[model samples]
Target: MLFEKTYGIDLGSSSVKVYSMIRNKSYIEKNMIAAKGRKIIAVGNEAYEMFEKAPSNISVSSPMAFGMIANLELQEIVLYSMMRKIDKILGIGSVMYFAVPLDMTAIEKRAYYQVANGHWLRKNRVYMVEAPIADAIAMGVDLENNEGSMVVNIGAQSTNFSIITGGRIIISKKIPIGGRQMNEAVCSEVRKRYNLQIGTRTGKRLKLVMGRLADQHKQARKVVGIDSVSGLPREEVISAYVVNAGIMNCVNEIGAQMKVFLERIPPQIAYHIAKEGIFLTGGSTRIPHIDTYLASYTGYSFNLSDLYETSSVTGLEKIIHDRELRKWAQPITQRKL
Candidate 1:
């Protein structure tokens, strides 16, 4: 008999995270693909390298957008490519657990099933696990308890606010705002203030370096970009204040929405959440003092998870290995269209 393998996969918009139960290791790669007119070129981190710098003939793009699978075909290709790299044996009878957004429609949920049942792994089994549930598990939240827990995941193109109680999700919402929007806001601020045209990647670097909310210490970083005024290449020193200004715009909006979301919760559940505070985990939450910043808006403390982008996959790892936690992962059955 052949040994079966199990994997936990989080197909995030910015990157793909996979955890191999057999290997007991996690893998992360940029969820990008580079192609030249239907011809395959590169995938994963290699493709990300050519993102802003690739020639006109070579197009680099992500198959996922806003935490959803935007292009099913390309998405399948990317997943298969990454799986091959992780393990050479694309053996039958393997099991896969995918962490998916809660707000996805039936059709959207089916897309995940399609990808798993696609050409590469037709004989494998697929399970669907809500992203927030996995995140909470990774954060060491006691989901089996009656206490309510709130989780916020800020990804590349979207932010998910979810409430979980008694091992089930109570309410969840996905907003089309996240790290991408923050990066754009940074670029926009730079253009308006210094007449410099910087790419989103540059803006991301600036955010990582200087994005602060509670602590507004002064800082600066030199960046190269196109001069908006002269249409020529130029280098400029950008202040942390400008970067913070742009980031706060998005953060404030999320906070305001979070406030409204919390208002609708029942008093009893709200009470538990108040005691436990909010469970925050995601890539965009990496900004310094962001937890403190959000605390001010919602009037609640936050427990920040250091797992960052890999929280969901890490949680899935536990679910796959532990029989008790496996109850949260449901098999994705085919739905008639």
Candidate 2:
């Protein structure tokens, strides 16, 4: 029961994915926590089920905010709860490989190290890997080559853009527009145009179901929401066009940032990006025609990862065994502790 093992932990704002080297499989779950007073009642998928639908006494939320650790205590609780569900904790010297945001500040990076080294983890064995690099590896890009490639991850709370060459990140940037913002925009637009106030979950459902390119299929769905005037629940027919328009602002923002990002890179790298096409990953990439929409705006083709959401963890799994990939790992510094 005290077997030594290494875990690849991708703790994102929307979900937590873990890749176990010993088990050779991955665990994926929504990164949610439901608390009643000071006590945590649930975590992961179970807590996600209660989001936006929990009783007044129970608070359901993600411990992370804007891709960084916001509530240290809550994050620790959620991390421990999840680890326990997977296997028994053996305490000290249990190696862990963590996928970290490339643009995070020193303090933010410290938060991740601290959480992993907290009581239940192996403080000295915690290793860090850049999230975007891991994603690129998972996508089958040869980071060791002299050629360059660009990777864009559209997460729940933030989007990360990285320019990579020679197995290292040359330039990386993060924007604060993601799935949550898109859902909020959808809710706001629906309320403005239809006088219907919808829940976060409902808005998200509509975005995924109807958010598509201009020429994509036009379908309609019945959406239930509270009427602004009556404050009573009512049903309204919402078309894909309306939903598409609602989330377009977010899509355009991402495109704008991409244009800016490309402008800053060297011409040689930019040329590589053009030939390779920008790689897209993360849960938000699943939105219908998102790549096409981004391509139209940027004037370059786009490539999407088949396992966008779990790409980082999958790459982490690969790193544990591949000596060349393991060279990218950065050991936790003593100064941070």
Candidate 3:
């Protein structure tokens, strides 16, 4: 017999996160193993622990690149592993709902739907959901009206800006600025100035510990990285001021994209957005001062969706429970040839 709960998978670049409802609350988990080489040595928290600690033979890599599936085979591997992992916890088969970027073409979207089905590996009963739309639906944005709501998901490799009107993607933009870009830019900056090199894991810690986009007035934290001049291990007292500089590059790029989104809306439609402004999600938005930066730039009040990290995944709950949303979602998996 089939299980009753509907599960959602947010197939992310660096890791895969799953969210299912358990007793009305969202049950979520993620794997840190970046897919590289022939095998995924670690998944989820174990992989997260191995991120910087792992040996060279095991290089952690993100299976997805630029908001699309770059490695189909590894994706299947990790996905199947994750599905089985979930099955172990639930003790039953699940109806799956997976989300993809808004700008994904018809064929590309279908490919993800197929991945959700796990056809090659033998999983089934898959449903496809758009990332942006699911995010809005979970955020409680009005779906029935043509007034429209914009969701900007700042992820690891790419930023997705989608406008959903009547619960569908009418216009959207996918830009190549995300969490990874920020880390790389910081690494580049430190290397150029200090001649110091660091790993993504180190860069990630720097970005999170003191990552900021606000002014120099705020209290800053001193962080360590490779020293440029000595070529020896070094530590520098980094002010949040210093880190903010690296983060703003991406924030500015996002602002520019938001401008494009603003232009795409007609004057009448734009008026409605003026009332609601834009909603921000994804892992990057969690950075300090990002929300304030966008608000200051656009002159419009911007709000961040609750659970910005799990918004897309948990949002599918609203999608499946409602008939209208289910209509927008097509079952691409488990189809007979």
Candidate 4:
């Protein structure tokens, strides 16, 4: 049954998500690997645990960055280990679909095909689907209808915007603003306000709960960092005000970019989108009141999809199982391979 096995892979910058048709379930893990020298010590969840805490000689990092493969060798090790660790029957003959970022260049696209083809899948059985289309399908949008819809995926490294009409992406744009930027904003605020240096993880934690200044909860979180004044380890309590202040600029920038994107869209497509509203998905959307914040700027209601982190893979699963929906996006086919 190797030839019959189907898998949907979302090779995200922050995490790797897999959907197995044989098991009829999806698996997700942080897209990180920990290693010493040439040997891989751990991958996925285990590697994620080492991040920000691992000692010297141990390096933990993601193979993909900004939704593109930055290290092919590391990516090979990461994917090979991740797939096998999840299921032994993943390699060879298994049809694999990858959710690819829209702004990827030709070389970057080829790199993705190479990663899948190098192992874990039959050479030509690897397919590519635009990340936005996958998110749209997961949201259960009627892609076949003449009406158009807009999808906004706010990921760790970037925010992707795509206008889908008749099951195809009419226009797509990617902005280098996402959770990472928000996290940095928080970090900057902590340093400037409290004279404390916090890790990215700590900043992200604050943003997930209180990203909006308007809805700042009366909450405080204990954070450990170096005291800028003393240059020593210090512990401080950070409030929602600090967190919101850190993320305010990044969120505002996202809203401004979305407005510009909509301004460039043709009136016909814009009309359809205004009627259908906007679909918001991605890990960053998990931020509290983010949809409401964006809705204020876009002038359209934002509907946050359930399982936003896994939406792209869910869409891939739908396409693999529903033949009638295959036309929603074309796959990169290699008949000769």
Please give the distance, in angstroms, between residue 280's alpha carbon in candidate 2 and its true position after superposition: 0.9
Model 3 score (lDDT)? 0.71
How many clashing pairs does model 4 include?
0
lDDT of 3 by residue, 1-337 (tens): 4447667778887667676554444544444455457555776656667776677778865567887887666677677777666555544345778887765576676567557555444454677777887788777787777576778888888888887777577888888999989988777666665567777766677788878667445655555666666767777655555556777877888898788678878887678777887788888888877888898887767778757768887777777666777875667643422
Q: What is the lDDT ranking, best to worst?
A: 1, 2, 4, 3
* Clash number for candidate 2: 0
By TM-score, the better pick of 2 and 3 is: 2
Pairs in steric clash, model 1: none
All models: lDDT? 0.92, 0.86, 0.71, 0.83
Task: Give me the runs in candidate 2 sitting further than 4 Å from their true place.
Answer: 1-3, 89-91, 122-124, 333-337
What is the alpha-carbon lDDT for the whole of candidate 2?
0.86
Instruction: For candidate 1, give the lDDT.
Output: 0.92
| Candidate 3 local Cα displacement, residue 290, angstroms | 1.5
Best by TM-score: 1
Residue by residue across 52-108, what tens digits does model 2's lDDT show? 899999999998997788887788778888888787754566678889887667788
Which candidate has the highest lDDT of all? Answer: 1
Error in Å for residue 193 of model 2: 1.7
Better of 1 and 4 by TM-score: 1
TM-score of each: 0.97, 0.95, 0.87, 0.93
